[model samples]
Every structure is written in structure tokens, then in C-alpha cells.
Target: MNLFLDSFWRSVAYCLRPRVIALSFLPLVLMVALALGLGYYFWEGALDWVRGALESSSMVNNVWTWLQSAGAGSLKMVLAPLIVIFAVTPVIVVLSLLMVAILMTPALTLLVAERRFPQLERKRGGSMLMSLMWSLGSTGLALIAIVISVPLWLVPPLILVLPPLIWGWLTYRVMAFDALAEHASVEERREIFRRHRGWLLGIGVFCGYLGAAPSLIWASGALFAAAFVILVPLAIWIYTLVFALSSLWFAHYCLAALQALRTEKELAATTALAAALAPSQTTIDVQALPLPDDTTSDARPQS
Candidate 1:
């Protein structure tokens, strides 16, 4: 608990660092550029397709009629755009997170290590290729989880609980491994992960919940299509910042746990060596006592 809270506060403080603030923008920029480029190319086509689908669907047509009857006909104009926005949102979020993980996590982890654990050894256990593979694999699984879980979303309680949990798990998996990749050996990383899995996952889950806040902007932006241009980028930036903070949080927690693991091992080794030498040292001291100089004592006893 102490460890968790300590890392949490440290991460929060680090996020305010100028370096971190600057680092966060890289992902944001990349996401914005990608979003804009795609928007420019596919904007009209996507809208046309969504409108055609909505118009052709019996269920949606009925809903449109009901909404018109209820005098909320204006909503129908935005419905297709809203659907498109929601559809694209998940992609933006995932890409932003991956960009931050790939581009920024190493630097953040290094910064945390240099500042807080200068003496910590770098085992270079995980390479960039391996980290990329791990991240992609985890992300793929998370996406699959989302797809499979969508049916359950109709259950309101499950809807609230499930997505964040999946995102949390994904965040935990990606961030924790990246956090320890440079400084901790494979064994050390696994050990720290096993020991601190719960706390790390809790951080991920909390950050996952925080990540959901941007959806409000997305929702609002969709409702007000006039503001879509501004809000979409704003939401992407928020996602980038959230992931950056999450990276820092995981970095602090994992690195601290790794440091403690090494310290504990060192202390154990020192104690074991002392224990192993104690009997030999006792014997040497006994032997060095010189048998009380029996000959000299005998010779002097007559006096």
C-alpha cells in the first residue's frame, strides 16, 4: 500500500515535469496528423456510407420515424456522424497509447531510473523488438476482448465494469513490461510483476477510468458536429497525456519494485555469507588463543 501510494504520487509529480509535458506532445501530434490526413481523404465517403446504411436499415428507419414524430428530427442529421465518430474513437485511443508506449515509455523509464534509482543496473533484458511484439500482442487481445464483450454491454452494470477492466489489463500488461524492460532482467521483471501485479493493475484500472473522461468530449463533439474538428484533436491529446501519465506511473512502480528486489537480494546475500563464515571465524579465534602459554605458566608456577 505504501509502495503503491508512493509511486502514484511520484508519477503525478513527474507528469508535471517540463520534460514529460514536452514528451507527451509527440504522440498527440502524431495522432492529430493521422486523424486529419484520414479525415481529409475519407470524410465524405465515410459520411455517405454511414448515411446509406442508416437509411437502408429497417430498425434505424423506424427509429428515425419515431424520433421525427417526437419532434427530435434534428438528431437524425447528426446520427450518422456520431456513429462514425464513435467508431473511430477506439482506433484513435489505441494508436495514441501505442505511440506513447513505443516512443515515450523508454525515455520516461530512463528518466525515472536516472532520477530515482541511479545505482540500479540495466540488464537490458527486453529489447525494442520484443517490447513491440508484447505490446501488439496485448493490444490485439484487448481488442478481441472488446469485440467479444460488446454483446454484454447491453447489461448496464457490465457495460460500466468491463471495458475499463479490459483496458486496465491491457494498460497493466504494456506499461509494466515497458517500465522494467531496460533495468530489470527477465527474471527480475517477472518477479516484480508477480509480486506487484495487484498494485500495478490497480494503477492501470484507475488510469483506465481516467482515460474514459475524453469520451465526454467525443460525445459532445459528435452532437455538435460544428465543433468536431476542434474536439477530436482535443480528445486525442487528452488520451496521449493519460497514457503518458500511465507510463510514468508504471515506470515508478516497477522500477521501485525492482530496486527493492535487488536490495533485498543483496541483503540476503550479505547475511548468508556472514552466517557461513561465522563458525570458521569462531574456530580461528579459539585456535589463536595460544593455549594459555602452558610451558611459560608451568615454568613460572614454581616461583
Candidate 2:
């Protein structure tokens, strides 16, 4: 519990560091460039498709007619763009997350290690290839969960519960693995996961909620398209910063757990060695003791 809170605050503080803040923008820049380029090429096409689909759908047309009858006709103008925005928002989010994982996690992990655990050994348990594979696999599972859970998202409460939970699970798997990849061996990493699974997942879920904050900007962009040019970059930056903080939190907690695990193993080994040598040392002490007085006196002088 102490470790959990400590790492959380440490990560928050680290996020404020000039270096970490700078690192956060690296991903933001890349993501924003990617977003702008994609938007440039496909934004109009996507909007057109969404508008056509809405217009062609009888059910949607009925809804729009009903809305018009109810004096909410202005919503019709907003619906197609809203659909496009919502549809593309998920992709943008996933891409931003991947960008941070690929670009920022390793650097952030290194920063945390150098600052807090300078003496921690680098076991390189997970290589770059392995980290990428792990992240992709976890992301794939999370996406599957998201797709399967989409229906449930219509439930007001579950909508709040499900997405963050999936994101949290993915975040936990990816960030924890990356944080420990360099400093903890496979066994140590597994042990840390086994021991601290709850706390780690909690951290991930908390960050998952933090990650959701950017969605407000997305929503704002959906409502007021004029500000979207400004909001898109801002949303992407927030996502990057949130993920960066998550990387740092996992790095701190996992590395500390690894250190504690190693210390425990070392202490246990020392104790076993002491136990193993105790009888021998007792025998040596007994052998070195002066002869018993009666036996020695009788043998030496016969009184």
C-alpha cells in the first residue's frame, strides 16, 4: 500500500519534470503529425461516407424526421460529423497509446531507473522485439474485449465501467512488462507481477481514467468543428502525457518490487548458509575447548 501510493505520487511528480514533459511531447509530435496527415487524406471522404450512410438509412431518416418534428432539427446537421468523430476517435486513441508505448515508455523507464534505482541491475529480460510483441498482443486482446463489450457500453453505468477496465488491463500488461524489461529477469518480473498484480492493475485503471480525460476535447471537437484543429493536438498531447505518467508509475513500482524480491532472496540465502554451517561451527568449538578438568588431571598427574 505504501509502495502503491508512493509510486503514484512519484510518477505524478516525475510527470512535472522538465525532461519528462519534454519526452511526453515527442510522442505528441509524432501522433499529431500522423493524425493531421491521415485527416488531410481521409477526413472529407470519411465525412462523406458517414453522411451518405445516414441519409440512406431508413431508420436514421425516420429519427431525423422525428427529431425535426420535435423541433430538434439542428441535431440532424451535427449527427454525421458526430458519427465520424466518434468512429475516428477510437483509432486516434489506440494510435496515440501505441505511439507512447513505442516511443516514450523505454525512455521514461530509463529515466526512472537512472534517477531512483541507479544501482538496479539491467537483466534485459525482455528485448525490444519482445516488448513490442507483448504490447501488440495485449492491445489485440483489449481491442477484442472492447468489441465484445460494445453492446454493454449502451448501459449507462457499464459504459463507464467497461472501457476503462479494458484499457486498464491493457495498460497494466504493457507498462508493467516494459518497465521491468531491462531491470528484471523473467523470473523476477513474473514474481513481481504475482505479488503486486492488484496494485499494478489499480495504477493502470487510475491512469485509464486519466486517459479518458482527453475524450472531452474530442467531444468538444465533435460539437464545435472550428476548434477541432486546436483540440486534436491538445487531446493527443494529453493522451501522451497520461501514458507517460503510467509508464513512470509502473517503472517505479515494478523496479522497487524487483529490488525487494532480490533482497529477500539474498537474505534467505544468507540465512540458509548460516544454518548449514551452525552444526559444524558448534563441533569445532567443542573440539577446541579445553579438556575436562577430571580427565585432564587424572591423565597428567594422578593427583
**Cα TM-score per model:** 0.90, 0.92
- Candidate number achieving the greatest TM-score relative to the actual structure: 2
Tens digits of lDDT, candidate 2, 34-88: 8899999998898888889889999999998999899999998777777777667
Q: Give the lDDT of residue 69 in candidate 2.
A: 95
Q: Which ten residues in a row have the lowest lDDT in candidate 2?
A: 294-303
lDDT of 1 by residue, 92-120 (tens): 77888799999899999999999998988
Clashing pairs in 2: none
TM-score of 1: 0.90
For all predictions, the C-alpha RMSD in Å is 3.1, 2.4
Residue-level lDDT for 287 in candidate 2: 96
The residue pairs that clash in candidate 1, if any, are none
The lDDT per prediction is 0.89, 0.88
User: Quick one: best lDDT, which candidate?
Assistant: 1
